[model samples]
Target chain A: MDGDTRETIREVAIDLFSTRGFDQTSLREIAERVGLTKASLYYHYPSKQALLTAIVSPLLDGWRAVTDEAEGMAHTPDNVRHVLTTLLDVMVVNRPLASVLLRDPAGVVAAAGPLWQDMIDVATRLTNWVAGPEPTVAQRLRAIAAMEVLRAAYSSITYLREEVADAEMREVLLDSALGALRR
Target chain B: MDGDTRETIREVAIDLFSTRGFDQTSLREIAERVGLTKASLYYHYPSKQALLTAIVSPLLDGWRAVTDEAEGMAHTPDNVRHVLTTLLDVMVVNRPLASVLLRDPAGVVAAAGPLWQDMIDVATRLTNWVAGPEPTVAQRLRAIAAMEVLRAAYSSITYLREEVADAEMREVLLDSALGALRR
Candidate 1:
């Protein structure tokens, strides 16, 4: 029951955050929606930022895991495709969270401060791994381009203001990233 | 003489902002570097943000011009390549200003405010032009990817923490954006 309550609170918070914008939504509203008293909500998650951290952590963990795994693999054409596909999946699956982040970059970036930096560091490593060993300037630049290409998976949601199917995002983004890689 | 002093202040401010970061660099330091009192600097450009705006306006103008020009041309492979090359030149030529913006996106975006939104609007038009008439979701996604790829022209300065020759930036970013466009 306690686990279920926590999960319910998370789902409610994400829905509120996505629909209402992070800053506009308050803890009282979230607690009201979750059918929890403000105190109960506080027991589960102390602050709005704590809830946001909870929401964004998995996406960060997904990237870090993908980077770690890719670092262990060979930098071949097949492996690059596989890694990019996984990264896209992680991003697409987390689209709700990403929408919240993208909608208010200033507030979210400030709140997520260190988490944002961690993501950057993870991205740098992933880009390096994608560049392969002893990359020339062109190769390094291509790697950066390919990574940026993958961002469309989520940014398209905001820009298009509509749902692009996850399958379509995976197919289009994966191919586009590989194209940028010149593979 | 007034115009030269204003230009000199912009140059010194870019240098300091690029090295010490936008948030860390002070208007007084910029004045000192340019051999102006803060009062003199204010006469030319009222505030730190005004100085940044002066430095960044040309880059934004260049983008708006490219988008304006490209909108008039029919989207063809040759035109696409030509437009991409022109965009790369704008980014590469304004890299010093871009480096400051990229180094501190939160600060810059907040400061840029409406100008940043204008850039996004201009970028949307440029991407739409690149996508052409009756674009599919795939084409639209590809256009977004290509624009992101072009960001490497300036982002590389911060990411690599070194100068990538303008020639190399233009060559690699153009080809990479074209590749993402699948042209």
Candidate 2:
């Protein structure tokens, strides 16, 4: 019962936080949405910050898993493709959470410092792999552009509401990303 | 004196508003930055909204110019190259204001409404041009990816602080945008 209530709180909080700015949302709102009292919500999550942490914790774990896997592989094109394909999978699955996180202030997330650091570190690592060492301006921009495009494409799915299925969109995004990288 | 003061206010407002979110900035801060009294700031622009309007009006005009030029031409590859090249120039020149405008909520600028309408109309026209009469999902996503990359690249100039000259970067961006469009 305790765990179930906590899950309910987490779902409602994410919904409300997406529609309303994180700062504007209150525990009271989450409580109302979850049919729990503020005191109960407090018992489950001490603060909105804590609730956000709990929601993103899974995403962090997934990200760590991908990076850890990448660490074992050689930096070949095949490895690069695998890294991006796996990243695309993670992003597509977490589309709702990604949209919210993208819109929210970096400062807000940075307060949970280690998670923020990991994010920057991962982004830098991916760009490095794409650009290799001593990259020129064009090489750096191309890498950033391709990665950003993939993220945008995944995020677009929620709003685009296209008839195209996820699998096809996945292929389109991956192919486009690879093209952008090679171009 | 009036025009000069207005220019000063507009510039300062963009800087402060970019550093602080639109909702977070005060008219007093703009006045202080411009070295004006609140009364004088109000005299030039009725509200912070009006200040934003003044700052972006020129950008809107410039955008309108690019789009207007694009409208008269055929949506061929050569035409697309010309259009993006012109837009890249406009974006790089108005880079600071463009960065702030992109970051701020559409509603903040939408109050006056015509500018907002123009914004939507122009984006639609550009996307339509890129996507053709009936675009496939891949085509649409690729077009969006290219445009976003160009914007990100331009916005990055300030942060990148790279020794690369603007003209060379322009060519690089142009080549990249064209490549993305083709892909």
Candidate 3:
């Protein structure tokens, strides 16, 4: 139950989950990899779903925080740019977790219902805020598209396969998102 | 079955699947709604999966056609715009089917593995062609983002709840996608 062991277990679970898939990877295998008995592993994670929740919660928390901040800010061009930049930073840091969670989006939704719902709700809020008050239909569509452009941060890992630098991804995607929302 | 009955069945199935979900809808329910016995329905579709495949094949075929056509065209800006517009049209026509298929993407992938993989491969080819020959990492990333923007054609149904007209969805999403790809 020490911090190091907990972190090690989490690291091992992410590796297994990403390579082997969330459903395909078993808690038994995770325990074996971490040299812990099944009972001891359960003591930490409780269940496979719990382990997944632990793995992806950071990304969810980051997105929620972004939405909360956006709610308070004026929907000015500069503020929109700042919000997008921070959101991209969150995605960049959580790219590994995104790989696990978004690899099969519906599967993640089914496996972790509340967590996935929270992420969806956060995205909807962020999209609404970006759309601004009394936004035109076109403005709302641009906001949705802009949010989707930011998703390229993680999708680059799948499509380009580590060929693009993280900084380049941040820059290109941020600019592209702004361009998507351009007046 | 006659062509009219067959088409009617497909329409009814799409309605049920979109509202109730692909996994939640059963062949028996579709049969009941279509006023046919289960045996009669089975005679046509063979399984719920077959019905889904029948429902979504048009969209998949449209996408595959776009990819195939793009394969021959030079990756000029004019061609890119044409391709995006054509892709948007395909999505617009298939918005209802897109709702059924994309509502639970992983579930559809599981239910129709080969069809889903074929769609993914077609998407990759389209992305590559859109990226152009000997593309830079940044160019490839933009191609991916642009493709994601085009996805809003269907996602608009989920988010905007049919408030955005098909014409508006086509116009705005095409513009946003091009903007995402703009250098």
Candidate 1 vs candidate 2, lDDT winner: 1
TM-score of B-chain for each predicted structure, in order: 0.85, 0.88, 0.90
Give the lowest summed-lDDT range of ten residues in model 2 chain A: A102-111
- Per-residue accuracy of model 3 over B1-183 as CA lDDT, tens digit each: 455888899999889777656665667798899899889987777787888899888888999999999999998999999999999898888878877865555457667879988887888898999999999888898899998888776666556744777788788888999889887
Scored by lDDT, the top model is 3
What lDDT tens digits, residue by residue, belong to model 2 across residues A85-164?
Answer: 99888878887665556544332343355776666667666665666467777887777767766776544553355666
Candidate order by decreasing TM-score: 2, 3, 1
Estimated TM-score per prediction? 0.76, 0.83, 0.82
Native-to-model Cα distance after best TM-score fit, residue A91 in candidate 3, in Å: 1.2
- The order of the candidates by lDDT, greatest first, is 3, 1, 2
> Model 1: residues >4 Å from true position, as ranges?
A1-56, A95-118, B1-5, B12-42, B47-52, B100-113
Q: Could you give candidate 3's per-residue lDDT for residues A1-183 as a string of tens digits? A: 455888899999888766555655678898899999888987877777888899999988999999999899998889999999999999888877877764445445657978888887888888889999988999899889998888777666656765777788888898888878875
DockQ of 2: 0.36
Measured by TM-score, the strongest candidate is 2
Deviation of model 2 at A24, angstroms: 5.3
Q: Rate the local accuracy (lDDT) of all candidates.
A: 0.80, 0.69, 0.82
DockQ-based ranking, best first? Answer: 3, 2, 1
**DockQ class, candidate 1:** acceptable
Better candidate number, 1 or 3, judged by DockQ: 3
In CAPRI terms, where does candidate 2 land?
A: acceptable
